[model samples]
Target: MPRVVFLLVPRVHLLDVAGPAQVFSTADDLGHPYTLTYVAEEPEVATVQGLVLRTETAWPSLAPDDLIVVPGWRGPTRPASAGTLRRLRDHHASGGTVAGVCAGADALGRAGLLDGRRCTTHHTVQDELARLHPRAEVVKDALYVEDDRIVTSAGVAGGIDAALHLVAARHGPRAAGEAARAMLVHMHRDGTAEQVSPLLRWRSHVDETVHRLQDLIETRFAERLPLRLLAEATGCSERTVTRLFSRATGLTPLAYQTALRLERAGHLLERGATAETAARAVGFEDARALRRLRARPGRTMHSKEASWTQAHP
Candidate 1:
């Protein structure tokens, strides 16, 4: 089993810790032999979300294949004890992997792990990180980075993208895709991709109703889902459902469905499916309709084989 240890700081960002931890937990639920634990500088540290977290102050034994992560905290950087910093350095020096989310990278920097390593932090503090660690190569606008045994990510929900990338690198893209889909994440940001993917444009809502609608659209992209069916399923009037869907996803229900169909068709085409066959597979009326759909902006697709293990280096 691979062990993952998350080191916490005072007033830590809840999502920063929860996002990545949930990824491993989800993977473990799916039958991956993953062991997760939490350690902190204090026995009980307050979180930014108004909850106090009890943590193990003592260090845990870990094998070289195990992972250690530092999750970001709430305010300005507060220096941790030298003994704590030394543990981070010692773990990586012993061939274990270490990672950070957002300001957590500061902890790695203070531990001297960022020196000469490619890394990133939240966009708001990129300059500060660069100035503080002149020797570290601070990458900008990237969701995450990995150099040798060190991994780092941008802030907030960037933890999910970074964690998914780690899962992909270790298991396979299929496993990562399964985790994303299970968590209702619609897009998988690449390590070298911009912090935000265009596929996720205008998606900044947390309403369960809109989420349920999108989930249905994603699972049944190839079907003809009328607006009334969606509205009724969401238990709202058609006007209200349409307004909310547009507000939440920035696309009309039909537009969202079209995007989904085109996306699915792109996957089929990459797998050597003919245009007619792919169009039929994804609810397009014909090959001509699929061709016209593909003519839209950013509709070009790359055909990657189903074999996820060979997709990346």
Candidate 2:
């Protein structure tokens, strides 16, 4: 069993702590055997939401597989104690993974973990984090960033995405997908996907039918999904589905599916897959279609052969 130790700070955001905790806890319920522990400077810590939380003062023994998460807090950031900072540094030095959420990245910076590594935080604090840690590469407008073994995320709910990513890294995407479904998270965003990814861009509406249609298309993007099949799945007429999807997401059902396919193909290509393999894997009939998509203006491939590369690499 791997232990997930949460280092709670004063005035911590409730969701930042609860969201990721729920992910690991649910993974445990799903037979992943993750043990969660909460530790703070004192026995009791007050939250920014005015709720007080109890914690253990002593740090537990940790192994490389164990994770240490620092949940962000509210108000002006304060530096942690030298001893606490040392513990963070020592843990990663011993091959453990350390993560920072929102303003909690300050703690990682203070511990020298972010130096020479790529990281991110709440947009409001991006410049401040960069100024504080000049050696760190601060990525703006990203949901999260994982460089080497250190992970950092943007503000608030971004912690859930980052934690889900960690779950996927540890137990595979299937486990992470199950955990996300259990939490009612409709979509699981990849770390490489920016804050405004196509996967999440059109999800800000309240149309359940559109959402369902998108979910179906996203899950089976590689299959040939006819408009009639999509309409039937969502219990709407083909014309209604088209209008609703277009009105909500600014794209037709087929266009949305094509976007998903292209995005996945980009990732596959970035990982060194040949264009033919990527096209087949992402449901494209051949590399020619993928090449045409890439050749279109503003549709660059994400691999080294193209313009954009992996954020970590």
TM-score of each: 0.65, 0.67
Report lDDT per candidate. 0.81, 0.86
- Looking at model 2, which ten-residue stretch has the lowest summed lDDT? 304-313
lDDT of each residue in 159-219, candidate 1, tens digit only: 9989988888889988887888889876667665456543554356887888888888778
> Number of clashing residue pairs in every model?
0, 0
The regions of model 2 sitting more than 4 angstroms off are: 196-313
Q: Which predicted model would earn the best lDDT? A: 2
Q: Any runs in candidate 1 off by more than 4 Å, and if so which?
A: 197-313
Q: Which candidate gets the maximum TM-score versus the true structure?
A: 2
Clashing residue pairs in candidate 2 (N, C-alpha, C atoms within 3 angstroms): none
lDDT of 2 by residue, 18-92 (tens): 999999999999989999999988899999999999999999999999999999998874747899999999999
| Candidate no. 1 TM-score | 0.65
